[model samples]
Target: MNFRELHQDGCFLLPNAWDVGSARVLEAAGFPALATTSAGIAFSLGRADHDYGGGRVDRDTMIQRIGEIVAGVGVPVSADLEDGYADVAATISMAVEAGVAGGNIEDFTGDRARPLYDLSEATDRMVAAKEAAGGSPFFLVGRTDVLLVGGTLDEAVRRANAYLAAGADCAFVPGAADAATIGTLVRELDGPLNVVMGLTGGDLSLDDLRKLGVRRVTVGGSIARALYRHLVDAARELAEHGTFTYADDQIPQSDLNALFDPKTH
Candidate 1:
C-alpha cells in the first residue's frame, strides 16, 4: 500500500531507518513503510541530532541519504526533514523530487533559546509546505514539538488542529504518550493523530495507543538508541574484560548477504 493509505485506518508502526542497510533490513522484516530518522542519521554521522551549531549533517547530504534509502527499498519511505531544513517550500519540493512517499515538517527551531516557532509562523510554514507539494501524491505530516519543549497539552492540541486546517495529512505530536492526552487530542483534532513511541514518559503500548484512536505510531530514534546501547556494552566489555562474547549472537554474514542481495529478494 501507499504511504497515504497506511494512515487511513487503524494504527501501524512506522519504523525509522538510518541507512540503506537498516532500511532494507526493516523492509525484509515486512514493515509496510519506513521513515528516515534525523537523530539516527545524525548519530550515524558522528553528530548530535538537531545540532544548530553546524554539527549535524548538511542539507544536501541528508537529502541524498533519504533518496538513497528510497531507492534501496520497495516500501514507502517518509523522511524526517528537520524543520524542513529551515525552508518549508524548498524542503518539501526536495523531498518530493527525491521520490519519497511523504515527509514530516516540524515546528521546533533548533535553537534552544527560542525552541519553537510562533503558532502563526508555524502554520504558515505548513501552508507553504502543502503548496509546495501541490498535486503530488505525497503525505505531509505537520509535527509540533510543544510537549518536548515543555508546553501545555492545550497548546499542542491547538497547534495540531491549526496545522490540519493548513493542509497537513496528519498531525504529529511527538511527546504525547499518555492515554488521557492521546484521547483528548484524538477527540479534539479533526485529522489523523501521529504519536511517537519510546520517549521518556510516552511509553504507551501499541494496543493502548490504538485503543486511544491514534492512527499512526512512530518510534522516532529509539531503535537506533537501543542498538547503540548494545554497542556501548560490547565495547566496554572488550575494553575492560578483553572478551569477545558480544559476537556470539550476531546475525550470520551469509544471512545478511542474502537479505541484501537483489537476486535473493
Candidate 2:
C-alpha cells in the first residue's frame, strides 16, 4: 500500500506495536497499518526507549522483526528506526530494503534527559533515509524532539521544514500540544503530519485533528506504558505484602497462546 495515497484519504490512527504478538492483536482488532513503538520494543527486550535497543538493536534483528510483523499482518509496518541506529555507518539503501512501509528516525540523541540531535545532523539523517527509501517510497516520519527536548516551537518548525526539504515524507513533532499548533505545523510543512497522542499530551479527538489537517496520529507506547505500569504496581504490591492478589486481574496465558494460533492448518 502506498502511504502517499493512504495518507491522503483520511486520518490514519497508527497505534504503535511492540512485538509480533501485539502487532497481530492490533491487526486482529482492525488497525490498517502498524508502526513499531521504540519504547515498547525496547521495554519488551528489557530496556528503555531511544537507542536502548541495546544502542543499535542489531540491524538484522530490527529488520527481521519488522519483516515478521509485515508478514504476520496484512498491513504496512513502519519501524521506529531511532536515528537510523547509527552515526555514520547506516546507508540509505539498507533502510529502504528493510520491509518497512514507513519509519521514524527521531532527532533525539537517545537521552530522555537531552532530546534532539544537532539540527544539521538530524537533517542529514533524514536525507539519508529519503535516499534509502528510493522509488518505492515509504512514509519517512521525521521526528523533531522540540517540546520533548527543550527546543522552542519556532525552532522545531524551522528544523521540521528543513527535514521536509531534505526529503522526509512526513514531519513528526513528538511533543507538540493543542490543535492550533498542530494546525499551524500541518500548514507549515509540505508533507503529512504525525502528532503523538498519549495520556499527558495530545488528547484531541480524531474529528478535531482532521479539522486541524493531521494526516496521522501515533500513540507512542501509551498502551505499552499503561500495561507496564500495571505490572510494576502489581509487582510492588506483591513484594511489599507477599500477596498474589494482582494475579486475579491478569489475562490467562492459555488464552494468549490461543490468540496467536495460526488460522491456516
Candidate 3:
C-alpha cells in the first residue's frame, strides 16, 4: 500500500532507516513503509543529529542519502527533513525529487532560546510543505516539538490541529509516551496522529499504541543507536579482551548476500 493509505486507518509500525543497507533490511522484514531518521543519518556520517546552527548533515547530503535509500528498497520511504534546513518549501521540493513517498518537517528550532517555531510560523511551514508536494500523494507529516521542548500538551494539540488545517496529512507529536497522553492526542488532534516510540526507552508495544488509536508509530533513531551501541561494545571487547563473542548473534554472511542480491529483490 502507499504511505498515505497506511495512515487512513488502523495502526502500523514505520521503522526509520539510515542507509541503503538498513532500508533493505527493513523492507525484507515486511514493513510496508519506511522513514529516514535524520539523527541516524547524521550519526552514521560522524556528525551530531540536528546540531546547533545547521551542523547536522547538509541538505544536499541528506537528499543524496534519501535518494540512495529509496533506490535500494521496494517499499515507500519517508524523509526526516530536519526543520526543513531553513527553507521549508525548497527542502521538501528536494525530498520530492529524491523520490520519497513522504517526509516530515519538524518545528524544533535548534536555538535553545526559541526551541520551537511559533505556532503561526509552523503552520505556515506546513502549508508551504504541502504546497511543495503539488497535490501529489506524498504524505506530509507535521511534527511539533512542543512537548519535546517542555511545552504543554494543550499547546501541542493546538499547534497540531493548526497544521492539519493547513494541509498536513498527519500530526506527529513525539514526546508523548504514556497511554493516557497518547490517547488524549488521538482524541484531540484534528487528524491522524503519529507517535515516535523507543526514542524515550519505553515498553509501549505496537499493540499498546494501536489500543491508544495512534495511526502511526515510528522508532525514530532508536534502532540506529542500538546498532551503533552494539558496534561500540564489540570494538571494546576486541580491543580490551580480545574476544569475538559479539559475533555469535550476527546474521550469517550468506543470508545478507542472498537478501541483497538484485535478482532476489
**How many clashes (backbone N, Cα, C below 3 Å) per candidate?**
0, 1, 0
The digit string of per-residue lDDT tens for model 1 on 167-218 reads 9999999888789889999999999999998876355789998999999888
lDDT of model 1 at residue 195? 90
Higher-lDDT candidate among 1 and 2?
1
Model 1 worst lDDT window (10 residues) = 50-59
| Pairs of colliding residues, candidate 2 | 92-132
TM-score of 1: 0.96
- The C-alpha RMSD in Å for every predicted model, in order, reads 1.3, 2.8, 1.2
lDDT of 3 at 64: 97
What's the TM-score of every candidate structure?
Answer: 0.96, 0.87, 0.97
Candidate 3, 1-265: lDDT as tens digits: 6777888889999999999999999998999999999999998998888745566688899999999999999899989997998788899889998899998888998888889888888888998999989967789989998998899999999999998999988999989999889999999999999999887798888999998899998999999999999999999999999999999999999999998888976
lDDT of the candidates, in the order given: 0.91, 0.76, 0.90
Model 3 regions more than 4 Å off? 52-54
